[model samples]
Target: MDRPDHDRASAFDADSRRRVQVLVIGGGQAGLAAGYYLRRAGLDFAILDANPAPGGAWQHYWDSLRLFSPAEYSSLPGRPMPHQTGAPYPNARHVAAYLAAYEDRYHLPVHRPVHVTGIERSPDHLTIHTSADTWHAQAVVFATGSWQRPFVPAVPGRELFTGHQLHTTGYRRAADFAGQRVVVVGGGNSGAQIAADLTAVTETRWVTRRPPHFLPDSVDGRALFELATHQVRAHAAGDTHTGVASLGDIVATAPVRAARDSGLLAAHPMFDRLSPTGPVWTDGSTWDCDTIIWCTGFRPDLAATRALEDPRIHLLGYGNWTGPASATLVGVGRTARTAVEQIRTLLG
Candidate 1:
């Protein structure tokens, strides 16, 4: 059985520096998936998570956030997520529970609330510096994902806008903006879902660079994952005509579909700049908004990897820059397996 947090902390305190064969960063879906493979490969590895809890970034998501795919389709390697009660697409809490259970089932060595500060690479090994201790490892798997690095595009006169502004990371629920007029910026799934989420509670305007592209209602995350897989295979085979990008951007989830069908989710064109009260268009029209919610996407939290460029260090689950569909739960398993395989070869 795994020791309690206090026992683990005491152990780390006794010896501030430790050695491991491998170190996996960010105990989210990707890191856990990597742990699964590392365990099966008989590698001595430990997962370092910045969060205090087992659920990783999922625990921090908004209450209403749901997976794009069903439970069975959104699972990590070696385990299928348990079906959620009453909901085909599981919510954030259910996902978090499943992840916690996965961690326990595998008995993966995970250190929590241990923030990694930086890493220095030598000719033979990597020295990892964290808030809790120092670790020397033969290799490092960076599965930090992107939740910590939310990206918001710069719009003109943003500083002059006196109203409240927040990224999707800070948004919890629509009721928080109950009586306010809100503008949700971005045209992706997040913006559409959040705009749809707000329609019942307050006035909301969805802004996008172009008209929002809605995938067919029949197309969900499963089909999208298959398409991405096919696209990746095609690219590897030297054929770049896979047509994955041709499929529309947004997944038509239940709420998004309902809002769109009711005409409450209609999107507006991107504004030229921001005014004191709200966003202004090139035509000099402006809508008064009490708050601005940027549903902009995220960048990979890879700051620690900047100081070193070593082949022993591999990155997973940061979107296409690492691998196709790598950031998604179902997609991360393949990437994690590949990463572990490479690590095995290097360690041998």
Candidate 2:
């Protein structure tokens, strides 16, 4: 992978503060997509990333995690991810490499390890406060994403749990829970996959508020994106139609499929409360488990812009609120492109 062009000297003003027409927060896939269009628009822009290296949140995901779609369907705006041999879906490392290469291929201006503290608005520009330097920009593309703030729903007696508890963020490998009873919470892909991951090495139980929903084995990220896109177009044309939810929650990935075939993927209802040792269902049934992994999901890390209400500041890649399927690799391009065009007109 080509290294990102970190030479940001040209973006600095006379006072040594960096200034640009556009400032993209988060150097992950969403921010990079925004950078691709911003670069093409001939805008003087900079991407401020909090990580010490490339790959955004992908680098932080658990091992054995794979995209639900093949690499060709999971690409950024300018290039397709190189195909992987002997695998239907690329793993997280492959994704990170693709992103880093995309940055180099496009030569996007990316500043790394630069944590953006907050955003301040002036009459004509937005001032970005960062750990390293202050940046002034005509517009800001907030693509920080949700990984920074993992969500765990408030279950009763959660604080009193004596065993280990962690969100999906801290989970790295299934081997970590070997020989122990583990409960994986949530009905999303993460929960299903994590439960699958743990089932082989340990005693595992899957829990959700409702019975888990499973998409057909034929469905993958590609199909899901297409459905979401159709829904978006339908909505724009004043048609209210069912969206991706019509399919189901979790995609039947290889691991999840295997676990299901083995009859180990059966899900239990979410526990009503937690005892010191484990969880207690509404009917007073309890299961003793050594650890709980909450895969509930995430909220957008938009705290930096929480205090400001500026029209020039655009949010991207959080979820449907930003754009349909905007959080996905292939889905973010459309939203980023439109946001850049709007930013260009606003700057002009």
Models, CA RMSD each: 1.9, 1.9
Residue 12 in model 2: lDDT: 40
On residues 236-273, what C-alpha lDDT tens digit does candidate 1 reach at each position? 99997775667799999999999999999999999999
True lDDT of residue 184, candidate 2 = 93
Per-model TM against the reference: 0.96, 0.96
lDDT of 1 at 22: 97
What lDDT is reached at residue 114 by model 2?
A: 81
Report the Cα lDDT for residue 213, model 2. Answer: 85
Give candidate 2 regions above 4 Å deviation.
1-4, 7-15
Per model, state how many residue pairs clash: 0, 0
* lDDT of each residue in 237-326, candidate 2, tens digit only: 998765888679899998899999999999999999999999999999999999999999998898788644577989999888889999
Residue 47 in candidate 1, Cα distance off native in Å: 1.0
